[model samples]
Target: MPVVREFTLPDLGEGLTGAEIIRWLVEVGEVVAVDQPVVEVETAKASVEVPCPYGGVVTARFGAVGEEVPVGAPLVTVAVAASEGDDDAGGSGNVLVGYGTAGHSAAPRRRRVRPVQTRPAAVPAPQPTAQPAPRPARSGPLPVISPLVRRTARELGVDLATVSGSGPDGLILRADVTRAAAAVVSRETSAAAPEPAVAWDDDVVPLRGLRRTVAEKLSRSRREIPDATCWVDADATGLLALKDQLAARAAAPRIGLLPLLARICTAALARHPDLNASVVTEPDGTPTGIRRHRAVHLGFAAQTERGLMVPVVRDAQLLTTEQLAAEMARLTEAARTGSLTPAELTGGTFTLNNYGVFGVDGSTPIINHPEAAMLGVGRIAAKPWVHDGELAVRQVTQLSFTFDHRVCDGGTAGGFLRFVADCVENPGELLRYL
Candidate 1:
């Protein structure tokens, strides 16, 4: 008899507790290799493909796509040949990407597994727009794998044995149950007097996946953090002039406006180390004490099709303007292509949000939680400004700084913003800290 081994969702690390199933890579009754990616999941940080350490015939999958599964919850159950596993259901000591195992199991040889037939069972149905096809009558163990699916079927009075499965290998999915329930309603409605349809669900958007994560985090930031915003208008003429002069030089690495500002922000953080820290909070979210960081892990906000992502540049205080430009470019590309790792998306001690790319003047955006502050840069445009005691049209930009009031008072926050503004106006002053 093949030993049925369950594979749980391994911890993806970086303080993540659960992940939303983005898509299923393998189907029921498919033969899988050791360490083969079985599913793609999106955590609070990034989307990661989870591989199974045990190779065998996949008997069942636990969660539906778009459903959140907690860490340690079963993801799939594989029927491994007794010979393939050393002891009981012979398990592999093989490790997995985006997850970790305690230790390797010795003498676990990679072997091919032929798909096995699943014991049949029934599941109830639920309401769905698409109709599910009919399945021949079968009786056995429940065909449903996920407990949540079973719950839905029970609540909706769906009969698992009667309902047809639209999932892989006749596995009854939650949607199939939902569709069954919907069909029952439709039939019942036809028996009654015809009423006009409301189309109530047309405009309703579900807060799920990335959008849900973003919403929860932003809500926490607002609820927990005592934040204050401060802004300043600076003459960016000197900054633009400096960029042009540097580009004119040989092998200057194609300087950009954001990198230069990033350099300035790092210099300012170095001067005021107080801003480069996170507040240690209690279980009740009480601010206990301030914890200072030695290195500056700067995060820049990048908007992707998925949602807003902050890709962190490790040790931004150490990167030169050109180096910062290159790293920022790399991270930006990764963010846009949705290839960023969770490590790259987290542990940001401070954030730089260049909303200027969106053609906005200024915004007092919410501070990214746990981080002390975020510097927002707006569009740089030619505007009427003073240059050396003379009124002239100069490139001007609005820089806004939002900080956690628990870490520092208004005076410290104002000073940090002032230093950044001075660097923008005088460009050469940025060299003193460099």
Candidate 2:
């Protein structure tokens, strides 16, 4: 006899409530060891491998690949072999998504025995008049974490209690609430005159994984934050010369314009710490205050096959230009391969977006939500500029700064932007801070 233990999905971090199963690493009836990865799931943050805490034969799996599983939802059941002297079969002492090994114990496995049937006289069937009993209500907290989902439900006057959840463990998802609201609207519309049907030929690409997350985040940023952009065209000839000088050193690594800009941004942020923070909002989404961070956890925009990802370089204020270049290169590779973890993709105090690679001159970048500001750099091109009181061809680039209005006044924002432009136009200005 073997005791079966059930495992549920665990919270992956960053307030994420659920994950979509990408693929199953283990199948039913397969033997698994403790802490072995059983499935790969894609959360809004990143794609991650979920490990099992129990070591045994997998007896049952709860969700199929492509299905969304909420935190605390049963993922798989494992049957452990009964051991001598112990009344219950024990699980491997492992900690993962849900269960841990502390004071671990197993319950008795209940076996269902089939009843034997014997030949008997013909029996008549009863009339089917009795009504079926209603299904029991599920107990525990509703499977929902996003404040946006709750707000949408409240605005639509949808009763969350009445609607059933399709997510793991009967968790109520935004889709579930949306469907219920649509049903109500449909009934009301049917009561009045029906509208004419339109031809439908457009293809719907189901937004999933990272793409869906990015869409929701950008939408929320637009809806909630009052943001403003300030830009300036700077002469980058000095910055290019500085880069060339650094690259000429025997010990120096290849230097790009981004690392130089990143170093300038960090220095600028130190001078104006207000731009290196996030606004603390009240429950109703009102800005109560701003929380300024001391250390700079810098994030840079990286384009990948999955989609656009901003990988944060932790303790960026402490890293040198060469180190920043190396870290950025590493993260870019991770992003391209979809190997970045949630921790790597999040916790960014400020973001620096370099859209110059796309050959754009300037763009009013949307501030990455929760962060106070973002710095956008455009392509550096040779243009006629005033040098030594004469017009000459010089390297010129545009810098755009977007900031949350609630965080600081325009004057502080302007000062920060001006500092960065000064450093860009004269790389020597950064040496004082260095």
Lowest lDDT 10-residue stretch of candidate 1: 106-115
Q: Which tens-of-lDDT digit does each residue in 115-178 have in candidate 1?
A: 2456423211222323346465457765665565677789889888888776544667767787
State in Å the error of residue 382, model 2: 2.5
The digit string of per-residue lDDT tens for model 2 on 1-434 reads: 66666677765557777788889898767888888989888888888777876777776665556666666666777776545114343344454433333225242222212122231122112223232332322655555544545776898799777777664345455666776887787676666645674333334465877899888888878988899999999999999998888888878677788888889999999999989999898877888888999999999999887889999999999998899999988898899888898889989999999999999999998888889899999999999999989999999999999999988889999999999999999999888998
Best by TM-score: 1
How badly does each model clash, as a count of residue pairs? 18, 0
Task: Give me candidate 2's TM-score against the actual structure.
Answer: 0.73
TM-score of 1: 0.78
Q: How many backbone overlaps does candidate 2 show?
A: 0
Best candidate (score: lDDT) = 1
The C-alpha lDDT values of all candidates are 0.80, 0.78
Tell me the lDDT of model 1 at 252: 62
**lDDT of residue 179 for candidate 1:** 75
What are the candidates' C-alpha RMSDs? 6.6, 9.1
